[model samples]
Target: MTLGSRLTALPAVMMTPVAALMLATLVVLAPGLALACEDLTNRTQTAYKAGDLATLKDTFAAAEANADCSAETLQWMGKAIVSTVLRSVHEDVSQGGSLQAHETALREARPYGQDWRLEAWLGDIAFERGDFTEAATAFQDALNTLNDEELTPTAPDTAVIEEVYNKAEMARLAAADYVSAPTTRSGEPGGLAAPSYRGFQPAARLVPVEFQFGSTLVTPKGLRALRDLRDALRASGTQSITLVGHTDPVGGMAANDRLSLARAESVAASLRNEGYTGQIYVVGRGERDPLQWVAPLTQHQYHQALRRVEVRQ
Candidate 1:
């Protein structure tokens, strides 16, 4: 037999037990490796869904290091990283921090390569951070990338993809809002408060608010407190009130800034509707102001307490 033929036939002459052992090893280790990869994927998904950017980041880093990850898994990991970054941007804007931070996070996630959803998310973050110029640029980039070829119908077909696209559009609109809305001073104390209230003792009022993941709406409990506060302030003859919003250091500063503003605005709107005629000043402190000074608390707990609107009468 030729040398190549002999080499090919060598496998046929191998003992059945040896062949079986090789197959067994593959069968044993393959599934184990797959399961480990699956577990990591699930962890990343959970963190992304929960808007837990920090956890998502850690999991993505671990997944990147895993040799067993398939191409599809790696792609998913990349998407997760980008999504986490967008979520971080949203948190930063909601909390009223530097838009530069959001930009930095987006750049870090850019390696996932020309993701329209991610670009849209960046635009939205910029818009919320009051950087209309950046927001417009991001929105344009997202729209440029999106085409009918990428569109999919139905939840089973490409739900995640569609959802990401929707988020991009939302970001675009948010940026537009930044452009059209009345210019408000970012949490920075604008020009010294008129001297009228200089000597006024800052009356403090505790306001409770709740936030579900990915939502800024106030709960019934929050609305009730705001209504009561409105009535009390009207009767108390206070000249003005400071509406301060705070959040936990779970997401990026931009996202936290936006969330804080939303909370404060919700409360302020309720107060205005309830006939509060006094001056209302809104401030978003982001994660900078924590009710508790302790470190190492879970993001969930810290968020629960941090996502609050306090009224200083």
Candidate 2:
């Protein structure tokens, strides 16, 4: 049976008055299932605040299927679900699966009240249908109709909100970067390859130097690779080198940034100590320019890989 139907089939029976009392006591003591609905509500609000439609949709789906939900709760739950689906439609119009899923949710939630959420969903649908003006109008109307007074005032932990906000900002910036400087044939941003300077030519490049986890100390292999790079740069008559450090997403942004910077500095120091007199430009991009999105690496592996430095002439 389908998950929803199976959930609905669960017996609410009490064998006896005493048993019913015990069940009631259990419900009072452990209201996790009931509280899940509330959690969904909170998560939906968070998703909206962060402009994260994916999380919003997942939370809304959970809330809709909640067996403990009452008609009153369903009203908010329905609205939240619809809002999320609409956002998804706004993002990717060709996602027919998402569209159908939202349609199903809307059907389920419609009885609750077609409030601002419904309007927002309609706007999203219109946008997906390539009616941008209608979508904008709908979003504006939905925003205007939001019952700020009715919304629960309990705020999430400050740190979490800040983190989410920062990530959203980062994603927005990344999108802007991709649009402004499209990836070139060589996989670097903009259609230009790294300029050949000094003795170093693009064609003679070896495997890009990588780092150990969360450390600035270069591996013997990494050092050897740098030696080769130094020789090439010297031969090519390059006057300067740029050392860039990158990290995978594993920790807080500030911490990652610091770590990446430190890694770059460590590499630069090593190069300087080796009597390579060329000017060095050190930069760190912590977990921002990942080689892999949704890394298969364990947290330990990810952190290790992030602790790496690269050299460019």
Best of the candidates, lDDT: 1
> What are the models' TM-scores?
0.33, 0.32
Query: Judged by lDDT against the true structure, how good is candidate 2?
Result: 0.46
Q: Could you give candidate 2's per-residue lDDT for residues 146-168 as a string of tens digits?
A: 32224212222333222222222
In angstroms, give how far residue 261 of model 2 lies from its true place: 0.9
lDDT of candidates 1 onward, in order? 0.51, 0.46
Listing every candidate in turn, what is its Cα RMSD in Å to the true structure after a full C-alpha superposition?
23.8, 21.1
lDDT at 26 for candidate 2?
20
Encode model 1's per-residue lDDT on 43-73: one tens digit a residue: 7667656767677677767877888777667
Please tell me which predicted candidate would have the highest TM-score against the true structure: 1
Q: For model 1, where is the 10-residue window of minimal lDDT?
A: 188-197
| Residue runs of model 1 more than 4 Å from their true location after superposition | 1-203, 293-301
lDDT of 1: 0.51
